[model samples]
Target: MARTGEFLMALDEGMLAYFREMADEMVARFGIPRAEAVARINRAYAGQEFEPYPDLMCHELPEYWAYGLYFKPNAGRLPDDDPDTDLSAWEVRPAPPAGSPAWTLEA
Candidate 1:
C-alpha cells in the first residue's frame, strides 16, 4: 500500500480538492488540528482502490465526510438512492459540544 502522502499525491485533481475540503471541514467543525484532520482523511482513502472518487461520490457537502457519514457501510444517501434528497438541508447537523449553542447560522 502506498503511504498517505503518496496516495494523496496520486489522487486526481477533483478528488484531491474534495478531500482537502473535507479535511478542512473536519478541522473547523470538530475542532481537530489540521494535521490530524488530514491524517484521518488520509487513513480512510489511502489504501483504497476506489478510482475516480469524485465521479463516484454523490457530491454531498464536505460536512458529510467530516461527520464520518460517508464511511458508513449503508449510508443510503447517494443521488441514485434518492434523487429528491438534499443532504445539505437535512436536519442532521453535528451536535455542538456541551453547553455550546445548538447550532450556528452559517452566513
Candidate 2:
C-alpha cells in the first residue's frame, strides 16, 4: 500500500487532471478563455463541503438531527449488557472530589 502522502497525492493529481480536462474541453467547445474555463471548473466543484455555509443555524435542522449530535440517546443509557434498561445502570456512585463539575449546560 502507498504511504498516506502518496495516496493523498494520487487522489489530488486525479482530481486536478479531471478538472483540467473538463476545463480544456469546455474551452475548445465554447471558445472560453483559460481564466473563465478554470472558473467554470471551480464553480462546478463548489458544493457540499466546498460551498460556503449559507445559513447553518443549528435549529434549522430536524429535532433529532439537531439534538442527536450534541447529546447522546438517553443520558443514563449504559453500554454494558447487564440485561437491564434502567437508569440505575448509570448510577453515579461517587461524588466529585477536590475539583468539581467544570460546567453543565443543556440547550
Candidate 3:
C-alpha cells in the first residue's frame, strides 16, 4: 500500500470504540434492514476517489433509525518521497499514555 494509504485515525482506539458504540446504537434505533442499509452505504462510496467525510443521515425504520458516516479514500495515495512522509500535513495530537503509577509499601 502507498504511504498515504496508511490510515492514521484522528480518534484513538479508545475514542473510536466509543464512537462505534454510539453508531451501533444509532443503527439499532433506526432498525435499518441489513441488505438495504449495506446497499445504501455502498452506493454512497461508489467512485469515491479519496476519503470524503459524508454527513451522516438517518433512515427512519419501524422501531428505530439507522445512521452512517461516509468516507472515501483519495484515488491514489501520496508518493513515497512525498513531503507528507511523516503526515506533516495532518495535525496529530498524541494520546496520553494509558497507565498510572502505583505506590507500594516495602519493609
Give the best candidate by TM-score.
1
lDDT of 3 by residue, 32-87 (tens): 33333333322333233322222232122211222222112234332132334543
**What are the clashing pairs of model 2?**
none
Off by over 4 Å in 3: 1-26, 51-107
Task: State how far residue 40 of model 1 sits from its true place (Å).
Answer: 0.8
Q: Which stretches of candidate 1 lie over 4 Å from their true place?
A: 1-9, 69-107
Model 3 deviation from native, Cα RMSD in Å? 19.8
Give the TM-score (vs. native) of candidate 3: 0.25
Any idea what lDDT model 1 has? 0.52
For every candidate in turn, the CA RMSD to the true structure comes to 9.8, 22.6, 19.8
lDDT of 1 by residue, 7-82 (tens): 3435666676776787777666547656556655555555555456555663677776676632332355432224
Best candidate, lDDT? 1
Off by over 4 Å in 2: 1-11, 47-107
Q: What C-alpha lDDT values do all the predictions have?
A: 0.52, 0.32, 0.29
For residues 1-107, write the lDDT of model 2, one tens digit per residue. 11122111122343444434554654554354544444433332333221122223222322222122222455643233223534343432221122322111110
